[model samples]
Target: WVQKSLDVTFEEAVALRQAYLHRYGTTLGGLTAEHQVDVDDYLAFVHDIPIERYVRPNPRLAAMLSAIPLCKAVFTNATSEHAWRVLRALDVADRLEWVVGIREVDFNNKPRLEAYQRLLAFLHAQGPDCILVEDRVVNLRPGKRLGMTTVLVDATPEEEVDFAVGDVLEVGPLVARLLEAQND
Candidate 1:
């Protein structure tokens, strides 16, 4: 349905879903209240997207993540099953120490403080020392608010994230520098 709506970018779609949560206490509730759209239909439409085309494994990314001794986790708005599928396709499934998706966390998605809290709780982490790498500025806000070191991959000028870079492959060197600085 979002693809049919020319006005809806991926970011907009996410915002719409979030709006649903804000208005009706859940995305499905908002869909039902506003559009009369069935929850199942919405789920099917979201799950039907062609994700493989958009994601690919960067061996350099895997190597860098693996080299870091700190625990790593994925905190995504996608369902746990979808997250697993994407990670498996990228061949980095095993590298992740944890994954907290919508279903696993009772459908509380990001920019919700609850989602970040749940993720940290699940990981048994003390605070926001772990770095969060994301492609979207909207997604980074909650993580940033939670005190996590935020890195925006390919951020636009409007985002003004803590660190911005063009490619994930470059993260390895940057992480190395951060580690060196920490040791100093």
Candidate 2:
């Protein structure tokens, strides 16, 4: 669906996808900027998948999110519709204060400076006080550069991140400690 939407062969799509990420931060950004692809059509086509089949509801995750006392929101490269579906499926939609997706920032995705700036502006937030927890190390770079504390939710440790955890279970305590330190 993505290849057809982009009007490119599979191999061409793969190459262009990489090139797009390198240049425009997201395939949607590059396609719209360079090829004039319709943003709505592209997003709908690419995200038309069985989300429920992949995402199972987790009560533990919901409980963990409820335990955290900070204002929470989702910042994602996916469309808001997609984000909502996944969040709902996970049973954590209500816990979040905001959902910032690619559509919200005019198709700009993460690792892009403008997208980060727009997100912080939209949230009325400052960079230094924000904490970005993400699985991708590449995505954490921009947040770190903007002075946001970066948390890497990956298996291995990253020197660039302020904190690294193997999974979501470790996040609550680490965040609590950080918040406590700030209070002191």
Candidate 3:
């Protein structure tokens, strides 16, 4: 549905989804309300894509994440099953102390305060100090707004987020610095 309506490639579809999120709170809800598109078909199309390519293990990243003493969690709009699959594929599932997905949180997705609130509650964490790492600038915006320290992975210059890095591979040194700062 989204692919057909937007006439975009898979990458473009992801970008469009992100753009919609930036413009509206929810992609499916926004498309349905604004374009009168069928949500089921859009979801089906999304599920049709091969996710394996997008998910792969990064051992270096895993090591870095393991070094951080802060409790780590994954907050994603994807279903818990999907998120777990990706994490497992990435070989970092064990590093994460918690996994919060749309299904687990009553379909509340990122950019929504409810999702963040629920994640914080589940982690017994306070706002503002907790860190959130994401690949999308639009997704990082809400984290910043909620006072979390936001890091943008694979972000572009226009994003202008608090911290930007090329990939998860570079996160180790940064996390080390954060740990040093905390100890200091």
Candidate 4:
């Protein structure tokens, strides 16, 4: 479905997808811009994953989120419906103020400067005041370039991160400590 939607041959799909990510930050974004693909149909087709099988309720995660004193929102390359499903599976739906998905930005995903700009505007936040926690170093690069505090989760080398953590559970305490240091 993705190859058909992107108008790429099966043999070329992988390379095409990679090139699209390199050029436009997301393959869907590239398809939307260059091929005029229908955003809704494409998203629905791509994100129809069996989320419940993978996601389990974690009370510790919920507790960690509650400990963070900042306004929280989810910025995802996936559709908002998918994000909602994942959050509900994790039992953290009520913790976020909003979920900004690729559909909201006309299929534009991370690593694009405009996408970040739109997200900051949506949150009524400045880049410096925001913290971006991502597992992919490529995704974190744009946020770091935009002056947001970038935390590389489960990543190696830690070359470009303001902080690195082996688990998402560490984020709340790290934020708290950073806040304390700022105040001091």
lDDT of each: 0.72, 0.86, 0.74, 0.85
Alpha-carbon TM-score of each model against the true structure? 0.72, 0.91, 0.73, 0.90
- Taking all chains together, the TM-score of candidate 4 against the true structure is 0.90
Can you tell me which runs of candidate 4 are displaced by over 4 Å? 6-9
Off by over 4 Å in 3: 1-19, 31-45, 48-54, 156-160
lDDT (Cα, tens digit) per residue for candidate 3, span 81-170:
677778888899899887887666665677777788887777777777688888877777767777887788886644446778788767
Candidate order by TM-score, decreasing, is 2, 4, 3, 1
lDDT digits (tens) for residues 76-180 of candidate 1? 776677787788778788888778876666656676678778888877875557787888777788788888777888755444567877888766677778889
**Worst 10 contiguous positions by lDDT, candidate 2:** 1-10
Q: What is the lDDT, from 0 to 100, of the residue 4 in candidate 2?
A: 82
Task: Give me the runs in candidate 1 sitting further than 4 Å from their true place.
Answer: 1-45, 48-57, 156-160
Clashing pairs in 3: none
Off by over 4 Å in 2: none
**Taking the tens digit of each residue's C-alpha lDDT, what string does model 2 give over 72-122?**
889999987899999999999988999999878766688888788888988
Predicted candidate 1, C-alpha RMSD: 5.2
Which of candidates 2 and 3 reaches a greater TM-score? 2
lDDT of 4: 0.85
TM-score of 2: 0.91
